[model samples]
Target: MMEKMNQDGALETEKSLKRNNVVRERRISGAVAPGAGAVFRSVHAMQSTLALGSSFESDHIWKLGCLDGSSPDTGKGKSQFKSSSITNKVCHGFHLVEGQSGHDMEDYHVAEYRKTKAHVLGLFAIFDGHLGDRVPTYLKDNLFNNILEEPSFWEDPKTAIKNAYRSTDKLILEKSMQLGPGGSTAVTAIVIDGKDLWVANVGDSRAVICRGGVADQLTVDHEPHSERRRIEKQGGFVTTLPGDVPRVNGQLAVARAFGDENLKAHLSSEPDVRQIRIDSSTQFVILASDGLWKVMNNQEAVDMVKHIKDPQAAAKRLTTEALARKSKDDISCIVIRFG
Candidate 1:
């Protein structure tokens, strides 16, 4: 249910020279492009399905860095953040690869709450884009801030998140002229007061938690096959062609996402939200794009990172494993570990 192309999809538009230049021009002059380090080793031909025993090493290990007010336009590289105040007891890391695409549409954000009334909140998210990176970049810059700005965020996180998703998507649609014809899937995790965890997702990007060595998926993958009834009721039909996967209206693979302006009538931007009470049994959470989940199951991914102490290393390891397993899509991941 990840981003895939069909007969009428935007595959060609995604790879057009214009869009590629847009992505490149937005990146900082010296920002590292995808595949920067030993991070991207050659894919093995053994048909390894889960990357169970594979590993990767990189100097991109976790460390404490400045959480300046500046937002790093990490379009196609790696980033990690940890702190003693905002994210007091948590460790985290993230890695991104453009894969075979002309440009990477993936972006992430880790927002540190400062002077917040709620229990020391922190926000983390992964935005997997299709058609263009503008939507994801917009999400990286605005989604969480908009959510936190909601007056009801502290009193009613659920309704706040839902409203935020709708309003944010509306903003994206309103700015379609500037954002271009791209769209994006999102998985957002909000750690409230450090004891409550809230997650919301649209499309296939996902969030999973590791509790006492077991994997529990926090978000559902909204695939066209599962939502065919609703799409049909909305006057849209899911189509499946020989050798090609089923797509919504014979175009988009995901049933929901942000900013598919052309297909907004058929696609839904509302997210499936879940709340979990964090306890001693909770260990860490993984937020990733479909690139990793397409090749590995939740349990497999949790098992791979359960023993890793450094969250940054764990994120890099997960990205490396996906590449080794022959995943041919843009890969990105965020590992958040609680101590």
Candidate 2:
């Protein structure tokens, strides 16, 4: 297995290196604005050649929204993750673009309250939970803030990301004891210094970039099978089954995530992170639950919204397309456009 990984590692590593960073799920509790009801809370950051509300006119992708899904109750929702986006102007014309979860609302919000910077970072995530709801809710509230708040982020991003992933997973596992049997699969994107986008994922939630009519994947879906292949070659059988149903070990469907105390050895809950540099050729980005990607190919999605003039419209269409394909999982998408 080590030999297989070494041979493919270059490819995987290159892919990982070309696009990599850190991002996840949590609990929430607190008072939100009066008009917001049953609405999941989201967070995002951005860097641009233009200012907010300004008619964007340039070659840079604008960091737009982060979209995510959560169940009102902690136990019955999708894996929670962050979905960040951007858009490309292409040949001519303007494009429309746009852009949460919760529980432990207070801690998450308080942490969010600390990131008072003025960048427009978006949140599009799906919190898929098993055993309980508390952990997802906690992620809905805090993970984003934690990623940025870490001291090592600016100096050693990969290290910072690894640390954050493990730390968050540990915290979720610990809290779940009191909160519920909660553990969550997540995908998150954060715009750093405005020039880069970071995606961190555990499980199957996916992040994809549309460039030149090709769906450029920004992150990989960690699964027991992927892990299994790696481990099996190393003289290991971490999971009882393979192929038909993917699991971190033999227990969960997600490859990385928060909580899952019992599945720790088989499933580390650590995330794979990547950083993306957006340019004019970059059309848009999508972040969604497994339900969406399970049914659609990356390039297919890019083609769906490629020439469309409005990102929000494209996002809606993309989600609709997935549903039309009979995707039974919850679907959420965030679309962003660059002028």
Number of the predicted model whose lDDT against the real structure is largest: 1
Clash pairs for candidate 1? 119-193
Each prediction's total of clashing residue pairs, residues at least 3 apart in sequence or on different chains, is 1, 57
- The residue ranges of model 1 lying beyond 4 angstroms of the native Cα positions read 1-88, 105-115
lDDT of 1 at 235: 88
Cα RMSDs, all models = 9.2, 15.5
**Native-structure RMSD, model 2:** 15.5
Leading candidate by TM-score: 1
Candidate 2 accuracy as TM-score:
0.62
Candidate 2: which stretches are off by over 4 Å? 1-124, 229-243
Against the true structure, what is each candidate's TM-score? 0.76, 0.62
Cα lDDT over the full model 2: 0.50
Q: How big is the positional error of residue 122 in model 2, measured in Å on the Cα after superposition?
A: 4.6
